[model samples]
Target chain A: MLEGELLGVFALTWQAAVMLGLGGLLIYLGIAKEVEPVLLVPIGTGVILANVPLGGLTEPGGLFAVLRAAGIDTELFPLLIFIGVGAMIDFGSLLERPYTVFLGAAAQFGIFGTFFLAYFLGDGGLRLFDFSFTDAISIGIIGSADGPTSIYVATMLGSKYTPAIVVAAYSYMALVPIIQPPIMRALTTEAERRLAMPTRAQRVSRRTRVLFPILSILVVGLIAPKATPLIGTLMFGNLLRESGVVERLSRAAQNEMANIVTILLGLTVGGMMTARDFLRPETIMIYVMGVVAFALGTAAGLMLGKVMYLASGRRINPLIGAAGISAFPMCARVVQRVGLEANPHNHLLMHAAGANTAGQIASVVAGGAALVLVPFFA
Target chain B: MAEHVVEAPAPGKILRVHVEEGKPVAAGDRLCVLEALKMELPMVAPVGGTVKALHMSPGQTVEAGDPLAVIEASP
Candidate 1:
């Protein structure tokens, strides 16, 4: 009673110190390098808080734990983010170019391919890793290149590596600029990247815009009911934006709601990254497998885009196919930059955006499919 | 001088008024920035002109086709 513990230093273990260092690194990257600062900063701060000795931030009833329960564990934050994402997207480009959906679908093969590898390594037959079928599926969902979908699937499957999976998903997303370009360059040639796409897209009707979200929900929900929550929230947000009746509500969903949920989600995810859990070899393997899955997804998209380029009589820029990984404006921007590099006068932003938006829809569909398939196999 | 009016593309808030009344601008110069659907879209000068009037200000909301500014064509 006379000497109650004062500072957390005496309780600080090497693992905690490492985690704290890692947290500092994340904060550095967020502040100095500006790598996904919106996410990394909060996550980095959470990591520091959780790793501090006697902090109890990750313990039951703690702030991070509470946030995790309310948002990540319940899968509310990701879904809420989807509404913001949906409202923020303008699907007119996708509507004008429907065929790009094929590229999006093709990109999803990475999810399945990575699943098989992860299963074989962990639980399927090889047992090379500690990944159970559930764990493998959770890791594989990283290929979706979608943060919320990854969170939802990992949580739904009850994987032990949810933290790793979330980190991988967001990290890879932030690296989209660096990751996709090399693959895009490797897959296409000077001519292919230089291929000029039509500048103007056919105007999409407002009725069509309204109907697209509704029709998508029905079709997707009917096909993969498990994906209903993920897809449902996304389409709901899109519908709110497209309906032309609720401007204030849509804006709020896009800005305020998105920002609040993102902060909660990022912090909770970071809080989960305690050393004992995150330092395992399995976690390392998850990170490795995540890169593989993302690369495969990107390659598959490029391959499909090449096919479309050939099929469309060379009118399509295969670079746009690389945009099918659902990294949103980043992927589209990458494609546009590559296109312009090959041909200074060419403008591929809209065309790349078309495929990019389709990729967004397709990633959601793939996530729904994973929800259905993971349970069937696991 | 010929009068040219720039219109808003969609409903959004004016995030930035890049030019003021009587400022000379060339074609493609950004006159203002509009925040819509969480995207920052710039309203560019449609033609070489002098900004005659600014119909909107930062933080003001706008609707599709609402006039944003008026430019007097330069000859």
Candidate 2:
């Protein structure tokens, strides 16, 4: 009895053992497959630590618990990470092609659509799962295709399935290259994909560049007060970068601040995934819904692209619509690749980057919109 | 003789130059490949012409509107 009491092996439950294996798999994907390694590696480590029998890391007052309370609960980590993301992103592309903003907005239909579907499956209609309005909203934000926004919105809503939601969001985001292409190809004809956009965007004045973040904050904050925190921090970081005089602060936000927050946030998120909490039918459903959310978002964007393509007399390549997800340059690259396959000389990078960056803003706005709507409905 | 200056469409690194100075090229011929935002953007000839001058080489970074090549349009 003494040996059994002392030996963690003897105390290990099947769930814990399974969680340990999952942790190993996450780490393997990070290292071997090189998918979101920065977050996944730390998260995998945290999962391993949390699952070890009697580690107590996830117990009350333990490190994981403390970090969770301080960072995830308070929504500090995701907000700080936004600053880094803002600093790293150059709005130049978006500024060059302002019309792509519509495509970005259209892509957000996925979030609302998936939310309704998830809700209908649960208490809202079929009584299939335990997904609350808040839970459904949290799951749907995965459609935003932005990890920080996913974490921030999920945490704020206090959803029980945040761990599953976070995992699905990050994992599917890494799979954007695979998820977006087929849908992009299916939606656009060869002629639509072959259309080439003008390479040069009209020069944007420095004054306009400096004003963008400020005006964006004012406009978005007024429209969706709940989004103020998420958009505010992001724009502030962009302000720091575009302000030109604060290069040092911008660099710090882009690198050190972002890195530190990512580490803590990743670990906290991973530690939240105890096998008992993570291994549920709802978790599997969340993963499936995540793919649905992405497809819906991609399709919505493509539909808008087709509309704009017709409106523009085929000047616009509908493939750039796929870039309307928040996966950043990956979505943009996919658009470029697809456009090239249709016509080798067709380069859609600039236009796609415009839409991709716009998608970042639109995703945040959608997250804010959910934050507002979910509570009212709940 | 109408001379057209081909400007870099976007800021990026020149990955490969497909034409030499004095090389005759048709419209839409690839002049050079510019890599920007992790995507390869092939700058093509806007009009059929002789390559009068190549202003950029592989590995050189350029900004939007920077002259990439000078094309002397054929009569």
Candidate 1 lDDT by residue in tens digits, A31-91:
9999889999999998999999888888899999899888887888999999999998988
Native A-B contact fraction in model 2: 0.44
Q: Residue A144 lDDT in model 1? A: 88
Q: Model 2 residue A333 lDDT?
A: 86
User: DockQ (Cα-based) per candidate?
Assistant: 0.07, 0.46
| Candidate 2: tens digits of C-alpha lDDT, residues B1-75 | 899888876689999999999989999899998989877777788789899999999999998778999999999
Off by over 4 Å in 1: A1-5, B1-75
Q: Write the per-residue lDDT of candidate 2 for residues A1-378, one digit (tens) a residue.
A: 786668999989999999999999999999999998998999999999999988889999999999999999999999999999999999999998899998899899888899999999987999899998899999999999999999999988989999989989999989998998889888888889888787677788888988999999999999998999999999999999999999999999999999999899999999999988998899999999999999999999999999999999888888888888888888888888888888766778878889999999999999998888765679
Each model's Cα RMSD: 5.7, 2.1
Question: How accurate locally is residue A247 in candidate 1, as Cα lDDT from 0 to 100?
Answer: 95
Off by over 4 Å in 2: B1-7, B24-31, B42-50, B65-67, B70-75
